[model samples]
Target: MINTIVIDTEDMDVKPSAVILSIGGFAFDVTNTSETQTAILQVARDPELALYSAQAFYGLVDTFEQLMMGRSVSSETQQWWRAQGEEAHEALVGERQNLATQLLHLSGWISQHREARIFFRGTDFDGSILEHAYRMCGVECPWRYNGKRDVRTYIDAMTRGIRGYVKDHQPCFAMTKHCALHDAMNDAEQMTLAHQINSEMLAA
Candidate 1:
């Protein structure tokens, strides 16, 4: 709801690694709780990614061969995904295409929402991967770093500011729906809801 561009990235490597597997996001207008079209990237799948299954698939290893272009894998992270449930597992696999082509599509989306504040759960991972992709294609990053925001801080603060409480209930998408595109969509929807809650709190 806050004129946000919610984003998420699936990476081959863990921290300090830009080997992103996919990027997905969408724009949201907090004013009307309106959402824009979603943007998703499909990179070239790598066979080597299959080796990390002993630890865990995380979305990258399980979906690597099915996904698009990406960097090397992170064994530690792979184990984490392997430990997740089927719902989370299902979220990793998605449509596939070349990294360049997918980025081109993502680039256009970013451009359209250039003025909006870009939000990512882990800006270090998601934001860095996005910049790396644009750099790889020799395209300028559509949004300035200053305009980019972190979802964790904003959501936590807003929740407390409004004295909001999270209910003990099932999630809209099970843990299996933790894929890159779906996660991005989820973040956007949460922000939209947060904006609405904030508005109501202020009005009262």
Candidate 2:
């Protein structure tokens, strides 16, 4: 009965600290991992947004419209993602959702699924981008303070047991597609797995 929201976010740039370029998220139960709901919101781009390097654009943004419309570009992060591999680029842009609409939609979704706790892989980075996005949209965030859960910390504590179980039992997480949607869904799935494994270990 535990509903968990797994989320991932991509940044627009590095130096000034980038704004959120895109977001992928999904909700699933820790006990019933098979049933999941997902959301992807790619921010609309600024018309004057300049590329750090022409090649950097190759991976991150799918179109001019999908780019973060109000925020400026990040040269350092652009060069960094350029070096990261093919799939990494897809994270910046996917299905387009205006930042304002995306914020409203997420707020509504969270409200509907009030029992679901938000879980992000990178607490600091993801939290910052999302909070900034809300501020940019002039919207109050949906969740109460401390509503976000730390997947990294929970997973870190279960690392040794999870590693042994995976090695011996061959449990696998969904692929890290580098797409925001897929990554977020993966986090949801992994959260369920983590809860399952930890409970089993403790019971044993």
Candidate 3:
């Protein structure tokens, strides 16, 4: 009896009362006025935090490369790389330290809301990304299959579930589209898809 119905961000409707959930560059704008009254949940990563982690990892790799190449480390490059590494280290450590607190907050948020649906991009690795972010934020997601490797299967299951829900509930018209994972979609394209899905969902 899963009451939540999660939709991809690109499929969101732009209704006035829609709950918007934005994570990374993706967003879910859900119309909450349906008879079911599902809450739209958006899970977004903090760009600054992700950037810090990436910079740190990249710096360490580049430093090791420079060392292997026998190139003298310029003072400027050394300083810049060291700073990036430190920033990343700090960000990661902070996230780990706060993991518990973040999870509690997420659990609370989900429990408080009636119909809670999570939206993100990429059916392959997005779940892992969300899990890592949640860990950093001190939250433990009760939802199973919230990892990157499980996404493909999870999506397949979701599609089947949606299909069944539509058939049983007799929605006007239900539509599902598969997009490239992790690729960026232009604003126009995203908006168009969102509108199209809304129209179809309403028709169902």
lDDT of 1 at 178: 51
Per-residue CA lDDT of model 2 for 1-204, tens digit only, reads 546776676665642234555656565576653443221111113211112211011112222443444565677777766777665664454455566676676666566567777877756677767776677668998876677777776665654543312223221333435556556555555566666677788999
Q: lDDT of candidate 1? A: 0.55
TM-score of 2: 0.69
By TM-score, the best candidate is 2
Per-candidate TM-scores read: 0.68, 0.69, 0.29
Worst ten in a row by lDDT for model 1: 35-44
Report how far residue 148 has shifted in candidate 2, in Å: 1.6
- Model 3, runs deviating above 4 Å: 1-29, 32-97, 132-140, 146-204
Encode model 1's per-residue lDDT on 1-204: one tens digit a residue. Answer: 335677777765655435565565656664444332221111103222212311111223223432343445678877876777785555555555555566666656666655677788867777876676677657677778676687766665655543322223233433225566566655655665666666787889
Query: Which runs of model 1 end up more than 4 angstroms from their true locations?
Result: 33-70, 92-95, 161-175
**Model 3 lDDT per residue over 1-204, tens place:** 222323222111232111112222221232222321121111112234222321100000122332343323345534543555343333222222122343353444445434434433344333443354454434566455642222223333433333212222221222112211111112112332334455666788
The lDDT of each candidate is 0.55, 0.55, 0.29
User: Could you tell me which 10 consecutive residues in candidate 2 have the lowest summed lDDT?
Assistant: 49-58
Residue 107 accuracy (lDDT) in model 3: 43
